[model samples]
Target: MTTDTELKKEIAYNIRAALPKATSYEDYRKLVLALAESGDTTGDKTVSYINYTLLNNRRMKRWDKTLKITDEQMKGIKAFSGKVIWLVLTESWCGDAAHTIPAMNKIAELNPGIDLKILQRDEHPKLMDHFLTNGARSIPKLIMLDANSLEVKGEWGPRPAVAGKMVAHYKKEHGKLTAEFREELQNWYNKDKGQETFNELITLLALENVGNSANL
Candidate 1:
């Protein structure tokens, strides 16, 4: 079996190569528009779906301006005395990515120790396969690693806890992730105001401190 450390080293190697080629959020915004205007059927309806996700992300980013962390979250961030890398697997068209990434960006901005990098999910199949949610290739999955050792500290993703449960309940009742369910999910994000996502991440990051015996 590939040990966890070995797997993370592989993931870090892939990330180093992909970071240079990965598109920025602005660049991805342009690509989504270009894909929509191309009039090509190469990806069929995927282009249209991505276009919708891009637009939704724009809205979420704007609304994410009010993201604020609690005192506890600040303390958790402060406990990290070493540099950490936040390597995230995402795509421009993932609805969950649209809703969650802006707040993540904000969190990274709060701490100089945290360096954030985004890579497209489809482009990193093996890495994505390792972080599957319910055996699905879920987007917006994130892995936290030690900058020096490249050890995987913890991971979180796809959606915040409350929103994830909402999705589960919706899928259970509706039999699929339909448009109605998606709209409801976004609505929940709007009301939550990124609190759940931020809280979850702070908790995840705190685990890293506990592992290192940092004063928390």
Candidate 2:
């Protein structure tokens, strides 16, 4: 059996391999928009997936336009000096990715040192396996890597803390999320205005201590 260290090394190797293929936030947006136009999705091309892709495309556009980072959050993001790559795993049909990735892009825009790369989860199963949330494949998972060494420094994902709790509570109560609940979650995301996601990301950066450490 593989030890934890060995698994980490293997994950790092997979990340390096996947990095070259990952798209910039701009390119990923273009891809998603094109898919929306073409009635297609990244993974299984079913009607439901296609419809979701279309909806997410619209959702992402709204987020990209309206999501705001507070002055304090801006300062926190700008202070991160370490050269790091935020490799995100996601897909076109994922609603959570639609809500959160634009916020991530906005944060990445504040720091030149933070390179954000987006990859399709299905395309990089090995890398995705390492960052699974609760043993389940969750999209929009952010894997923070040391730019020079490719070491995994930190991670954040799927949903913000409050949203995660909401999901867990709903799941515990209903055993699954209903369409109505999913709509409620989206409404919550809209009301929150990406503040929670931005706050959590800033916390992750502070915890990583990347602001104080120089890139080697």
Best by TM-score, which number? Answer: 2
Residue 189 error, candidate 2, Å: 0.2
| RMSD for each of the candidates | 3.6, 1.6
lDDT of 2 at 76: 93
The CA lDDT at 125 in model 2 is 94
TM-score of each: 0.81, 0.96
The CA lDDT of each predicted structure is 0.73, 0.91
Over the stretch 130-181, how does candidate 2's per-residue lDDT look in tens digits? 8889999988899988888888888998999999999999999999999999
lDDT of 1 by residue, 4-32 (tens): 78886787776566657655445554564
lDDT of 2: 0.91
Q: How much is 100 displaced in model 1, in angstroms?
A: 1.0
